[model samples]
Target: MDAVSKENEVRLRKGTSLNERLVLAGIAVILCLIALPGLAHLANGQWLGIAALFALLFGCLLLGAALFERNVVWIITPGEILIGEQRPFGKLHRRLIRDDEVSGMRLRKSIGKSVEFTLVFETESKDTLTSPPLPDITQVRKTTLQIAWLLQLPAPELAENPLDAANPRIRLGKPISFKRVRAYRALVVLLACSLSLPFIYALWSGKLSALGIAVWSLGAIMAFVLIRYLYRTSAFWIVHDGAIRFERLSLKGTTETDTVSGDDVEAIDVESGGRKDSLYVITIRLRTGKKIRSPPLAGKDQTHAVQAEIIRRLRLNSSGDA
Candidate 1:
């Protein structure tokens, strides 16, 4: 048997659940009903409503099957790793890994802090496969590490917050720092500036209304809204020790910690961009396979130190020499 098939024999469990499918179907039905009104005029709305009702009934049946079915496994074992979506309509998301095409897995962040550890592999074809939305936190994290290790990839350096593992149920404190806005807020600011430019030029060149004071007032409102939106987008945060903290601000506030054990963490990585005046970006790959990246705006020194600390911890825990 191939390695994948062997691994499947050892680790594959019936992971799928009927209840999960029912839930997905139910959600889909709800969406369909929501769209029924918009399409109602096409068939006097009768067909749309009937279609939505049928969908809802089908969802209920699937839910019922999920609630009572035991022989049906929630998770299916494909030769390769596939993410079984919790929703009913979800099909198996297959992942195909080739032996020679494999590269080391690394934990990285994508847009909007959707933290994930990606298995790096080189293939002649540029197609990519992403697992469906993960089912749970622990499973996701565990999967990231397992896949990385299997491919002989360096585990991403992730920060450990003992308090988070000790008390996952409670909300841990976040750093209230401006540096937190580094990643997302920076994008927002750039977009805002881009949007405001034409408008500002229009006002300045007298091409549009410099008419009443409303022009200036409207300009101010637009600027304010853009600034505020940028602020909100910059709100990426992380929890450490006993505090919930924001990256840009220096103040540490108290919050309840979660109950997850520290040993549960799977992978962590720190990344920084730019050489001169480089910004620090810290990414925590959780046991759930979900990764979170702290925004770069948090200041260079602080991020570097945090990265070092995380690397130190990972090195200590790791069996290989640093």
Candidate 2:
């Protein structure tokens, strides 16, 4: 801790969250898979055709929201900035930013969708650093201004509305959103409903004989496959200052959590450089012979950047090379 960090009152901040909702919903979905179809006709589930379709589709959204709620927040102190996930269910992946490293501060407009300005920090050597996306809210804006004052950098200016089309701010680096895309959810929900309706109609009309039951069972399997896809698609990594945390939960009620210190990570790797979506993935191999992978992120550059930064920090923090 330094004088600046010591003088600053420690505070934590976050945006509107979907944390517990996802956890509980995902848990319910997990339990539903256990003999629900065999015990009850197609899980007796009107839920899937109408109500539950959205649930399966938005599985990634909920997972991402939960990760954001529990982990994705900023903790500011006078001497340093703390970043990463902060929650009991999430491994606390905290990165400490010293006052001396930050050479400047600026407000930047993000790329794509509704543009929003977020606080960015420049290193002494002029390398740019960014925090999680921030909307044009008062508290974070105030904090950014205060940090600029403390760092003796050019203060970040306000943009009209970062989420608006009129955002006239400098754009930098690969953009990331705190939430998943809405279109993916919508698409999934549509598919689920398409699969579910025929079975529901057949059952309601009492036309679902043994043959119909067999058809419904097959449909049920497909729905599970889709749900599992969504669940696994939600997998991702949160890069902390000196550590990394990966979350992988399947639709089958199985979860794997890995919190690896910088010293333990052997390397970071990315695949499908030019591709997007599920085809693009990031992998981190640890010294312990375990390899962790990330879901499809925006682009290869972003993955590579995060990987390089983590590996660099890990090497710096560790006595041996990464």
Candidate 3:
């Protein structure tokens, strides 16, 4: 690549926030702390030995996730995209590819538009490729459309702005997205709280067993700590250079910068659930009959905001012919 081409390759830079890394570490520490005492108590019995082994296994898993958190990164270069991910062990997983290799892209609108998924670059030579869920819908669409536009020499006939009535994009400074905890984590917290409440009530009434109450109390504390840690640490971001980034301190991180030029994107859509109160999903359709989905769904207002901003950028790029 020439100097100009190399410069164009560095379109965006996005990283996972430090807050997320702290949360992963916190969760790991709590898991180890909780498991240690339980494992020690099992030394005298055969069943306890087995239980200790399981506890140790769990601890290892959490610790591994915590350490691998540092490997997260999403980078988009002129010819390709790069996603860095955290694996079970201390290994870093990466996916790197160019626009020409991408088969197609589409934005998926899920139930009530409450959820959305993106599909990109399904190669004929391979049966399957793993795609992680992205939290920001607009970024997914932007990345998808950029890839599609970059691959084709000429643009399609689709409308540049599909929804004329929608408002224009207002630069919201830096994009922010919360990489919230998922269903399993929420369920564990809820169950722990539900089980602990009765024990506390019984203790207050002077009818509870002290040992039982202590166990319940400890479990409840762990649950609260874990949930809070997850919430505070999760985040996603998009920066000024048409880049899309997603990261969880411990779970997954991906970034795509140097998107296809705005002039090539044919249309964009911000969608949400069926009912008025449902969540939102953003979809971008390229001129090549390709569609791209954002990471997941967002609130209705947030979805609208991102969609408007992307469209605005596209328009501005056209006016300047940049």
Candidate that would win on TM-score: 2
Candidate 3: stretches off by over 4 Å: 1-19, 43-57, 69-74, 77-79, 82-96, 108-116, 127-135, 138-143, 153-322
TM-score of 1: 0.31
Whole-model lDDT values for every prediction = 0.44, 0.56, 0.51
The CA lDDT at 50 in model 2 is 40
Task: Give candidate 3's TM-score.
Answer: 0.37
- The per-residue C-alpha lDDT of model 3 at residue 169 equals 31
- Higher-scoring candidate on lDDT, 1 or 2: 2
lDDT (tens digit, per residue) of candidate 1 on 1-322: 0012233321332334455655765775676566556455445656656676666566566556554433211222332333332333445443445534433333433323322223333434654443322222223345545554544555644324222223332221243445554455567657667766777787678776646346556766776665555444333344444232333321232222233223545555556645435455666555677655555533443454445444443442442122
Better of 2 and 3 by TM-score: 2
Candidate with better TM-score, 1 vs 2:
2
How should the candidates be ordered by TM-score, best one leading?
2, 3, 1
Give the 10-residue window scoring lowest on summed lDDT in candidate 3. Answer: 1-10
Colliding residue pairs in candidate 2: 4-78, 4-79, 5-78, 5-79, 47-52, 71-85, 71-86, 115-162, 116-162
Question: What TM-score, over all chains together, does every model reach?
Answer: 0.31, 0.38, 0.37
